[model samples]
Target chain A: MTEEPFRWLEAIANRRDYVQQQIGTGSPVFAVSLEAGILLLGVGSGQSKVFEIFDRQAMAALGHPADIERVRQMLIDAAHLEAFTRASADVNVRRLVSFGLSPQLKQSFEQIFQAPFMIDLLLGEVAEHPSKDVLVKVNFDGGFKIQHGGVMVAAPKPEQVTLATDWLKANLDQKLKPESAALVLLLAWNSLTSGTPLPEKSEQPVKLPDALVEQLSDKVVEAAVLERKGSNVARYVPLMPLLTG
Target chain B: MNTGIAGDFLGLLAQNNLRPLAAESSTRAPEQTHATTVFAFRFRDGVLVAGDRRATAGNVIVADDVNKIIEIDRHSLLAIAGVPAMAFEMARVMQVSFAYYRRSQLQPLSQEAKVRALARLLRENLPLTLQGVGVVAPVFATVEAQGDKVVPRIYFYDPLGAQFEAVAFAASGSGSGTVRSVLSFQERFGEVKPSTMTLNQAIRFAHNVLTVASEFDAATGGVDPLRTVWPVIKVLDANGVRDVEAAEHLDARKEGV
Candidate 1:
């Protein structure tokens, strides 16, 4: 086999290895960012959640902890839409119902969040009271939380809408659950076909200092590049429970 | 009973010269930096947690695909938007703390308890906040209790140990100002209820919101909707987390959206 091809395969292995390591460590969080173009990680604990940042040796110029600290903070902190999932092993049927959620919902949430997973809730719900403040109205007693969103979707109409009608009719129902699903599909589809083109920048531009980049593998860099370019990306990833398992 | 935080768990870690990297109350970080954004909003029937995909340092876009949200426990969501390392470290500490408690108590921490746990984490990060590299504030939301159906909920926190619930919407981020403006105005235009509009409509609404946010919020960057690369949306209904398919979003979008 060609050395280049072998190296490419190795790159793929490296990406999987990174993900596997994160999974094995029981972090219980996996994130796929359209902008980041890769699976990002956040570690979950009962008290709080922690994110992971890799410092490249190149960033030695910026000073040790400071440079890495800045990058780590930025890596997990940046995003427009983020999802959080929390769950417990214990099931409290009573607590579940009080929040307007079905026992099933509670169970599902518990099963999901209870284990380990983090998703960006691009969309969800909220309730606020003058005195009570804004609270998550959905009562998830022994379950999970999953949140997500898309980057940019188009409002295709008339010609494009009609043109795409055939595609819709053909691929409509390998799935169901309605409304939300439809929107995701269209927006994703539209973005893939005719999304905004990215502006050209420094290929030799302000490279993120070599040292800082080193903490991450080639895969991380590749993913970041795609995310930066604004490509319409999608994947039906299992929550952390399945990922970790 | 003892969720992660200033309790014995942290105390024990302290004995070993360890500390939380994420909470707002940990010791002061040597330097102050990193920005995290936690996005949450009300959906037709429940609440959502959507975050930006970018993080900044001074003026640079330091990281993309940063996972700001953390699963504090099952059915609950937590996110931080502060000093990167400590915020995340504390988040991990608290996660392990929660698990320890869950194992010890043989039950998960209560939503209220989880809040308390985070408060403790913040309390510890106090020194750091004072120093400059503070984990400072984090946004936490979980399904506390729904009235009849699977209702969504949201919450925000302050350094002073305040957890404020938000109605309509709440946000934190670099381009938050611009994105918030778009969300506020768009929300004002009208609502597409989960019951009224199909799930597809909900996804479209989400996409529409994201598009608007991206236009204004530089942190959120992506291409317009296209084939294949649909945003994978999840719906929290009577049944936990349901993956909102792309076709449905499109169908809803076409249906008068």
Candidate 2:
């Protein structure tokens, strides 16, 4: 009976490996903060990976479609509830992540008797200035990190996440328009999925990777932006036309 | 009780047992804050919605800076003319609910569905309304797209949640009796119908109507040039809702015919 705890730990580790294997080939989601607002981009075959969570917030995920939907619904409910109980302006990513989502995810993950969530989520919140933008990356195991306005990635392959994010950070311009930012994210996605290395140096004028652009024809790009300057209080706007056009 | 889904914010609030105010505290009659004088009319461009800047509590002027006209979404305006607390709560809930539905469902809630949603909220609030502590008669205005043509619609709701489509105009609150009569008179005999007037003339007519109402009903604070407070007017067209500027209010106040 004394070895029960050790055995349980081993089981937990096995579950981690199982989840990682299940999500290894899932599509990647990327986000970058720009002068207009924050843009979240994801490419997938059928289901949508990008969604608006609140007035100034949006989310993108890569994993099992059902699990991603569950998390997305949970986020939407939490945001609305927060906006209801308090005010809409007070509904932000930090509170939603730190107080609401992270704990729920951790509890679900620790409860080994049930299946852990098989998803990696990227949530972005726009602010008046690009430097003050907020981006949160929530992992399958409930681990998360908050970053100030820059670039972030939730790559399907765990090993390439840092490489992809670093490449984006070095290559992404803070002033890129919505369409251009989407193109940059798509190039990074192509690089990560095709196992090709991004250029070592930044290109003066960003260009679509000719070799990798064709693969995107079969995939639908899901994108949304939270515009900073708008008369309406609801700032989250979908950018499907920006790419599809 | 958790559905593990989104799109119904009010339902979620009920599940959480969250109310704008405690329901059990109705043991004694509390002094209710009442907002007065809100109306809407179809104009040449779209719909012109306006609300007075006064709230009263049993013959006592409680506040003069209250904003009773609320923007539920970009395309809809809600003007309330009853208990300020309950009316504002309803507006807040509708705003969030509309947004929640759009974000979760990935499509705008239909115009019919949006109007019905307000009716549902009033129906739910019947308990408080019967207690005489919460009563809200509100006017809703929106621009609905029909095929390629966008048309403006106005709806007014009773405290018991009965919704009626306002063809030319609708008014609510203590001063509405006078405002309604004047509107009917203008629509029937004036040089231009309220629905056919230009934007500038519409603004002038709104100011004139509110001014006439305040002259008879103390609850409606008309054009208080000394306090520099004018009625809040918003225009809802195919594009969206935009506030009439304070300068425009000055122009309307100065050029009233």
Candidate 3:
């Protein structure tokens, strides 16, 4: 009977390995708080990877299509209900992660009888200024951190995520316009996906390959921004035109 | 629980059995606060929606600064002429619902869906409407894109939730009888049709219609010239809702400026 507990633990470990393997091949999604707004960049294979969750909040996820869509719908339902029952301004990232999504994800992950979610997501909320922008990275196990500013990355492996964020911390310019920011994101993506080591912090940032830059016009790029100076209450805008222009 | 993109805010609320209110006893109704005098008309630029700033309770004037014209979204305006509490709540729900639909579905709700959403809310409020305490007759105005061009569309609803499309204009509340008469007569015999009037002329015509209503109905506050408070007027065009400047809509100048 005592061996049963150990078997449960072993099962949990096996589940983690299985989920990680399923997600290992997915691309990384990036979010950077810029002077223009919070820029979210994600590349998808015909499916959308970036979504606007509310007026001031957006998300980018790399996971199974069904899992990503489920989380998207769940967040949308909760956000609209909160704005309806309370006020729009009351809907913030902290409450959503702390009181809503984190708990739901934790429960799903820990429950022995249910399948776990295979998703890693980055949620970005724009504020009146860049310093106060709320950027969060949520893992499949429901763990997250509130990145007040700077940049965030969601990748299949924790080591890849660490390398990319460390590299971004040294090189990213927060004031880049949408087009320039997208190029920076592509460079980080290239290093992560190609398994190439990024240059040292003191070294110049690397340029994206010519073939990859040419492939951007094919529309695989899904990008959006939460505008800081927007007049409308809903500030999320698709940035495809800005990037291509 | 998974409503997906086809889900609606109100439907989600209903699935959770979260109706706005529980039906209390309809008997022994009290004197509830009511708003009065709201109208809309098609103009050359687009549509003009206006409302008097008045709320009354029983035979007494309760407030003079109650704005009845509510902006539902960028492309729509809702003007209520009945119970202020109920109407305002309905307007708030509509505003949030429209935004929720667009965000979740990644597209704006169709115009037909928008109108039907309002009708559903009014029908749900039928219990209160029958109690003589929550009757609301409202006018809704929007601009529809027909091909490359946009046209103004106005609709009015009865207390029972029946909606009718207005050919040229719509009016509601205790003062509606007067507003309808003047607008109808002017449309046929005035110097210009209401549809042909420019934005400047439409501003004057809106003030005249509400002013005439105030003279006939005690509930309508009309234009408060003493306080230099003009009616709340908004213009809806292809670009969306824009507030008419006081200088454009109000004829009188401030004391010395």
Order of all candidates by lDDT, from best down to worst? 2, 3, 1
Per-residue CA lDDT of model 2 for A105-210, tens digit only, reads 8877778888799999999999999999999999998899999999889987767889988888888888888877887787788778888777786564556765
lDDT of 3 by residue, B35-141 (tens): 99899998888999999988999889999888888889889999999998889989988998898788777789888888887888888888888877788899999
TM-score of the candidate numbered 2? 0.94
Q: lDDT by residue for model 1 over B127-215, one digit each (tens)?
A: 66666666457777666554664556667777645677776666665545664665676566655443344455556666665566667
Which residue segments of model 3 deviate by more than 4 Å?
Answer: A1-3, A196-209, A217-219, A242-245, B2-5, B226-228, B247-257
Order of models, best DockQ first:
3, 2, 1
Best-matching candidate per lDDT: 2
Highest TM-score model number: 2
**Native contact share for candidate 2:** 0.67
Q: List each candidate's DockQ score.
A: 0.01, 0.59, 0.60
Candidate 1 vs candidate 3: which has greater lDDT?
A: 3
True contacts kept of each: 0.00, 0.67, 0.54
Q: TM-scores for chain A, candidates in order?
A: 0.19, 0.94, 0.92
Considering TM-score, where higher is better, how would the candidates rank from best to worst?
2, 3, 1
**lDDT string, candidate 2, B29-125, tens digits:** 7788899999999889999999889999988999898888899999999999999888888898899889888877888999998999889888878
